[model samples]
Target: MTRLFNEPSQFADELVKGFVAANSQWVRPVAGGVVRRAPTVEGQTAVVVGGGSGHYPAFGGIVGPGLAHGAAMGNLFASPSAQQVHSVAVAAENRGGVLLTFGNYAGDVLNFATAEARLNSEGIVTRTVVVTDDISSAPVGQEHKRRGIAGDLTVFKAAAAAAEAGYSLDEVVRVATEANDRTRSIGVAFSGCTLPGQTEPLFTVPAGRMAVGMGIHGEPGIAETDVPTANELAELLVSSLLAELPPSIATAQDARAAVILNGLGSVKYEELFVVYGRVAELLEAAGITVVEPEVGELVTSFDMAGVSLTLFWLNDELEGFWRAGADTPAYKKGRVGSPSSASTAASTADTQSFAEADRLTLAAETAASLPTELPDSSDASRDAALAIADAIEAIAEVIDEHADELGRIDAVAGDGDHGIGMQRGSRAAATAARSAALNGAGALSALSLAGDAWADRAGGTSGALWGLALQSVGAALGNTTEVTGSAVATGVSDAVSGIQSFGKAVVGDKTMVDAMVPFTERLSREVNAGGDLVTSWRAAAEVATAAAAGTADLLPRMGRARPHAEKSLGTPDAGAHSFALIVVRVGEVLASRHSEFA
Candidate 1:
């Protein structure tokens, strides 16, 4: 199974049991299965929150002295029932009554509303606060329709403090609503996730590609495009938030804001900070002053690979209550800053560039001095190597068509998109190689240019590895005019060794090396036997194909997909499959060009 859990249904029960057991000082279980009841302070109203599980420390972990008074939890990425919400509220409710807050989802909306009615019928007053902070969920005029995400913490803290300061349920609701009204959040996913015990993830995000508006759970997003750098991601998120936030809120109280950079698990803290650092830059550029910046797992989607941003518009009263001290195991009170008394001067630098005025001027004299071809044309082996490189470039189109399928395969056992990344890299290599060939550059020059372009187009562990292979092959055949079978064998052997050294994967590790090893072995054997280049490469392609198929029996021992990396006992490695295809197509091209070598 792809999931790391033992039993799917029992996951919720076991996790909740452990949570309540570990946190008995502040939390207790409701009579039903999911909700964990947490005690609120005396003279303070109760703050009730509920949402699906998996996104922990969120709906549940925040239940404490200064945050949520109680939390109703559900199965992984599933909503709690009305009964679960009511039961938890019963335990959490004190003399001040309960203030209900939850993410805006249909299931959560219905279930929490039903629980509110049940509580009202029992003479226990309750007020509701719904969080709709995701900017992609609705347009500016319809902000109420957005999804509540990392912004929940801002709302919860604002509401919890109101209740702690002895505000009535209605007033507590008002404070939280104000916070939610001014809040905006947006997220991007580098990859998607799986629920416990599920063989397949709910959806797949293509590798090296990112979905801009990915929901907290499995809901689809607005757009998918090439993955942007951390700086680019920060700009996109911050700019969108600035555009969507209320004008009054932006200008209110010196336009001060609280920025929360939340990691949805799997993403390292270092990467989160890299993104956060850029977010601070963009926010400052937009004239938005940030208060205490929060960076941590305030919310998560159980090993989901993504990050989100939330902005809370700060007001005087909310600021005062936020600064008030509170004691909780998972949460600590934040100190509010004194409003800036001085007017700061901002700078205006023109950022537009003039591209046409900056063209390089290379003289015809220098161009004439450069070699049109290599110095020597004696070695037939050099031509054979060039022939193989040319053929690999020719068939890049077929690989591009299979990008979607490769992504699907990756989604099954790894971050889907290996195919997309490979196709993109291959096509770029082909274009670069073809351009150099058309310019009449020698074999090594064309191959070297292709290798560099491949690396530039495909970024990530595997892409860089494959680019290394191409670079090694290019360098091995450098300045050689004619190519032969032995020279081709030497280039393949060196390229395989270089890629292996960099990737650090041995045979049976379920990586590209599995296919590369056999292909190089076949090439060396044919060279020693004095066979033609076509016959040698064809034999090598067959070995590569068999080695790729043989990888199905080996378990994955490398890459980030290790923990849940199941025994891929019947499927070929995506990298290995691509390598095998390149080998076969290159061999075919060599067979048609035997006269050139002879």
Candidate 2:
């Protein structure tokens, strides 16, 4: 278990501070993440890669010459917000467009894709290539859904090498995409990891057993077996990967592969080298050629006692790129050419100014998209805004109260971050809503600001979805003089519709949508029957609560939970439960102190 932490909530930010301080030669801090500290390279396509924070060398550690130009670091096991991605991209100097790359996860996909759209709209010409190289996450013919793991380095390196070689954005994306297609990885864990301040591990393996096909994110392994000797374990990993070579290699005898025997976290280099020895022997016996194989920690999962193997089936072009040198904080390869640098003081000042300019530009562009001024509202509407603010603040309190339970529920089949993320998002939303209401803003403006705050502060799939839901409802409510049941029902409908459209999750997915669909349907029915908003909301909240409970019997069809469908069967989705809880509390607020708004 983690022992040192100022605050579990501030861990990600605090570590980044120390990382930048120690590695100032390679990376400097940006608003959301980090970019190379060296001089700017005009017109070079910036290769920005990122994911959750625990994976050390993966993201921020590899920000330097011949590697990722920037990395959008997220909270522990959470994807960064779209705004975070955009800020890092802007700071990275997008003269030749930007190539966004990361592990293929739901949250990362949504957030990065959103940032890509925004960057392209700003004429930055951003493109994304999701690394889907882990063979365990999905089966054959479903490779697109596979998660990226230790193989992230191969894709990131290929793309960054191409970018440093002055390839165009399209070409860089192509190289990364090809690298992802060629690479495949699989892992096993002997023990699970504990997040900071957590008393227990996310999941545990039985004694003397190793969980096979485990994920880097605190997700439980797909299967378990008695632990084997180092050679036997190596054979398992090597044979597993060898069985699923990319289509380019027809036979083991005909192909050369770049091997990566990666230690997850606590696994020592000596232990990895022992495994790699057997892995190399197995490959040689199979008549395969290994090229520049790596045998140490690459992508770690906090303190997970696990290791993974990656096979990058190499062609001539890929071979050249693989051999190319890179100089980052953690990983270093052959000699690398350095970019021109300004003196320490001058460079710091210049880059700080550049980052600020980029930030201001992005803020201006975003402001153009959102309304700059709050709408004029009647006294009644302003009064309703106070109720909205109070309801949100109440949600924050409730979420905080149940955060630990939520985390446990999520850890059954997911990354176990739902509670932390929800707590952060709800608190941020509440603060924003309260401030807007205090400033005499109407319901529309208050909720909209709250949504943005929730999304920005939380930075994950749930965050984005909840943020959009609030924004959609706000749009439907507008600045009407009086809040009516019909208006509330319409807003709820729009919220559900917008969430479905943005996230593409439907009912029975075991997501929040499962509860949301039922609640919205019931609320619309009651409102159409001429019921008051308070009564309709209470009825809807009941339906939602029941629907959330019912999710326990259904297998997850979406998000991280889908991977361990069986493990999650007895537990309701954390998202659905949280949504139900919040709506129920909001109903009480509307029914009690805010009946006039209701």
**Strongest candidate by TM-score:** 2
Residue-by-residue lDDT tens digits, candidate 2, 208-275: 99999988985555578899999999989888888887887788886888999999888999999888
Q: Go through the candidates in order and give the C-alpha RMSD of each one to the true structure.
A: 24.4, 2.9
lDDT string for model 1 (124-189, tens) is 888788999888766778876677899998888889888877888889988998888878898888
TM-score of 1: 0.55
Total clashing residue pairs per candidate? 11, 0
TM-scores, one per candidate = 0.55, 0.93
Q: Tell me how far the alpha carbon of residue 303 in candidate 2 is from the true structure, in angstroms, after superposition.
A: 1.1
lDDT of 1 at 360: 18
Q: Cα lDDT of model 1 overall? A: 0.69
Write down the worst ten-residue block by lDDT for model 1: 350-359
